[model samples]
Target: MKRLRDSWLTFVKKLPRAYSGRPMAFAVLLGLSALNFCSEWPQGIPRPAWIDTYDRILPDSFGSARQLLFDHFQRWFPRVPASQPVIIVAIDDKTLAAAGQWPWPRNRLANLIDAIAAQKPLAIGLDIYMPEADQTSPDKVAGNLPASAAALAAGLRALPSHEAILARSLRAAPSVLGAAASAHATADTSTDLRSAPILVHGTDPLESVLRFDYVLASLPELQAAAHGQAMLNVALEQGTVRRVPLIMGLGNKLVPGMPVEMLRVATASPLVEVFAYPSGVQAVGVADVQVPTQPNGEIWLHFASIRATQNRYVSAVDVMQRKAGAERMRNKLVLVGLTGTGLTDIRATPLGELVPGIEVQAQVIETIFDGRFLQRPAWLKLGESLFIIAFGMLIIWYVPRTDSRLAVFIRAVPKSSAILGIALNLLLLLSCVLVFRYFGLLIDAASIFIIESVVMGSFFSTALLEDEAQKRQDAAREQVRNSGKTGAGKVFDGALARWKRIHRSSK
Candidate 1:
């Protein structure tokens, strides 16, 4: 009875820990994922450094391989050309060389507007801003003159004010002035900007569109003169402009973006309509054009790989000098903005090209008009999360179920765990690629792949450590049994061991 009790105790001691470390490791992974997910909500994010390093080294959340695949798909398929009915009145190197530097006298801009207006363009998008009275206006210059030069000051005041000249030019053309959206506490909101009428359908999308605290509108004279005004606020991710908002909110009023305003004026769209589903903002409708957007009212830009502004640009100087013919602007929407190196409006696009900001605005209009979109529904993320959970549980189960001590030592080259991880992710990637090829739906596969790979790797380590512990336990059990053996039993045990060795060798 004593011997039997000792043997039972030894057997119980040799047993492995309950469920090994799988539950612990899996719980920890889940907790970390939960913490990372807080950023998606209103709560603050504890963006851990290790996760960031991993994302950067392999696949960043911002730069999912899906984007690369989608961009290339757009390239290979060639659905629509990047051409639009837009002419960029670029204040480029040539324009600056011909007409001096940026912030040129308002009279010069007025002349440029007059020249463009004479072409009978459908609508002009003036991407420049004149927030304050022109310093170079004749009347203002006159006020700055010394008292001794009273006659010169009086003569200067007699000429028409530069503001009047520009305002009159704006009144002549159906021009949409660009205003800067500001968040600074002291931002200018003295001149009330004309808000785009947003008619909400389902849920109120007042909270969905991008919001700015204040707007730096053009002077009251120019503001009242232009046919329309659009906010020049652009959102960027890591210096790249991949998405653009169609409409935004300034204080309590809704504002149209540069491209949307240009389209609105061109199509004579009286009001912008917002379709808000239970999920979020679905689409923004104006005139006959229906634009699908993300929940936040931004569209994933479908930028085609074409020659950088091959024939899109007409120099500002050319327009001002009448060198660019009226035919260049006839029936076309003209976008005017500075692209001089001194003016900082350059941005990177996914096509690996750095383009002027105005070109991006023009492309937004082109994409909306053409209906070429790369849609990634927000629910797809929920799908990915569900997939990761199910797949991770499978990895946890399979990693240790068939594992054995002997197999651990004689493990196949490129460990079985690694093989499983690669094969499964590759198959998933193939599926995602196919979905993108045919449907134009950009499903993000990188983040899910990273998550599952990390989870499996952790479980793999736990499995190895459990195998090692089990091996040690077996050795201890064998030692206890061998120690209890008497002379005859010990001889029998040695003979059995020799026989086992001979049998193993035979195998």
Candidate 2:
């Protein structure tokens, strides 16, 4: 055993210690290994198992390597087209202030509908839910209007409750109304008062997020009105509205989406395709199709400014009075919803804070019309995990073996510091101009930055200490040789040259 140990040590010493390159190679391998291992993590990020916890963290800005890769994948994939048949007529702040406070008389809304119907739009979507009878019904209450506006007073007396009046006007025109579902219902609430969603059979988390709770429009009434009804749920993750689900899962079954299915039914296209998995769901035109097995199956919204549509802004009072022109509203999508400040249907978005509920629906319509859906695949996660691990491993292998501290220092500098790095970042920025740029796809450059900085710093530190010691040794040797006057000059020069060569080769 002693002899074998001696032989092993001798063999190790004899082997040229010039394997400085092996450390770098080993680091590259290590980084690759880490990336491969991280690929298996569910959802691409480290998430808690509970739903509530996940929701709390969802809105957080902490992005992962996997998220970055997914963004890249989307850039490469083909975006579908948008074909929304609905329009939004926001009851904006101007109209709200002009029309009076909450629950502007039913007659006023009736007048607005009368004017909107004149446009002959494809259909109208009412985002407001009228769950109860209005207090200002002409027959139920009287003398609410000022005598000066009595000409408008005469019209108010004949109008029905807002629900009945809107229902009547909707029935008269070729339009669709909104409806809510009881997915969030509890036995504590009255079932009669609560509306049920147009549920299929199965219940899914993604579907729940996508389904909307339409107010007054019920299955029977919504079915009886205009042409069809849509599920009005907006899918929001992390308080951010990203994608609109194309299909909704209710209870224990799968059903066509409110807007998506409505358009499909109206267009007389094939059945609505269902694209669902553990990650998310997508719906395609029911012919030969592709599945979106990405993180969240949402499509990009193709927005049209709400103010752009003409005759689109008739006040309720103007519409009822028939004082507004109808020519501008022809062949447009009509969505009626409350844009009042007092109303609670507001959400925070990147573009603006406290955006109206109608705007949310408008976003949905935009995505539907554009057909540019966001998808994530398992491969994206796989790729990201591999990147992280591989990067980490590379640092471990490369820094220590390098004799040329300067080379390590060059690698330590971030890739973005140079003109090439800056140009690369600029190219990414330009990609957004030529195409769509998703911020989520950015790499964790800082992490790599940290690794390189530490590795390079350690190498330089070692080189500095060794250089000082060598200088001191040369000084001492020269003094001793000068005093003794022997063959020390040749030996010392040879040793120093060999040391420099070793350092150069290591680098």
Candidate 3:
């Protein structure tokens, strides 16, 4: 019985240390970080999550330091921008009131073309679609009118053959009219191209995000009427238009985008260079010249203030009513769009709220002209993953081993965990800011930090608990042995006195 009891006590004494808590702690930490990672994961994230947030906040803390590191990386590993070429001519509210009501008469548009032709821009782009005949000029539609509908049809006839008329007018001028083409779509495909055409298999800034369809409306008659065809589609994601399409694959046909079409006609170059990478692509000037780069083929838009004097605006009504001449539009891009109170053509962006369509075009122009690019290369991702994993493992080993009594006694495991978390976060923040500000590359860094912190912290916590448990067991065993020795001496002395008294009485 004594031997059995001794064996049981020995087993109990060793139990805590035998649990092997460090590996389990590592696993728990790793799992926790993963959970945090998925919870905060953003949609359309192109790079590592850590890098994305780092780009936003690093500038706040250590301004230029962040950018320096980023540039260092970009200089070593380069990426190409998208090559699709296009430009936007927004038909905004100022032009609408100036031009006269929503959907102005066809003849006024004809005059605008005649004026544009005089400037001889490579090719004029039309975003407005004229699919049906005008309802106010039936005589014109029937080919029985000698004059324009605006002069004769007060409210009696619908204008017939407006698309054909516009086609005729544009054909006669030095401009091109854009169209919408529906191609290679299944029954379940969502037809949400709005007024723009649809094309499948488009490119985006990153593989993780969705790409917009680059579709162009095709009409042989209209095609022949103009110098060239360009896709008139602008891509919008999460209620914001960020990317400018350079190339779009439609019906197994790689079509030239708005920018591409514009550059082709402007330069008359047979082959324009198309840049490709994670963020987006851009069409460069030509092969001989150094190719340019841009993030999502986007640039800063310089708005012509509505309050400006001569640059303010020219109303379509003024042109129609002979109040304004064609000279105002000479050698300039004229965008006509509606800005009526009820007619909402607003889109959200990183800049501000309630941005107009024409401004979007302006931004595109700024991006192309300025050559500001942002992106990360494929190798950067692999580098980030490896770095994060190693950082996490280091935290797991070092944190528990730290001899900071205050950390263990006061803040406990939470403090150590926090330290690990902050370290990982700082590394990510620095990486993103450095790349974006200096190198002009936008890499995601947030994802890596979150994942590493949890993975490493978990290992530390488990090891800490086990170590504490073993120490407690040793202390308990020491107290038990001391108490047993003290009690044994008192019991033995009392038993000897009683035995001597009993023997004296028997004698």
C-alpha lDDT values of all predictions: 0.75, 0.50, 0.49
lDDT of 2 by residue, 1-507 (tens): 999999999765433222433444445445544433333333523444553454455532223443343334343432332444445565766676677776765556666776777877655666655445567777455467776877777777676555576567767765555555555554322223211233222224353334333223443432464455555656554464445555544444444435554454344353555544444443334333332323333443433333332323444444445554665456656677776567637665433344665666665555545544443345644654565456545544544544556346556776523544356446644553243434323233433433344444444444565577679899999898777855787788789999999999999
User: Model 3 misses residue 208 by how many Å?
Assistant: 13
Report the Cα lDDT for candidate 2: 0.50
> Least lDDT summed over 10 consecutive residues: which range in candidate 3?
300-309
- Model 1 lDDT on a 0 to 1 scale: 0.75
Over the stretch 381-439, how does candidate 3's per-residue lDDT look in tens digits? 54655565566666556555547563465366656556655765787777676666576
- Tell me the TM-score of each prediction against the true structure: 0.80, 0.58, 0.59
Task: List candidate 3 stretches off by more than 4 Å.
Answer: 1-90, 94-100, 119-123, 133-161, 172-174, 179-220, 270-344, 403-431, 459-507
Write candidate 1's Cα lDDT for 155-202 as tens digits. Answer: 999999888889899888889999888776454464358655778889
Q: Model 1, residue 184: displacement in angstroms?
A: 1.0
Best model number under TM-score? 1
Report each candidate's C-alpha RMSD, comma-separated, in the order given: 6.9, 10.5, 11.7
- Summing lDDT over every window of 10 consecutive residues in candidate 1, give the lowest-scoring window: 38-47
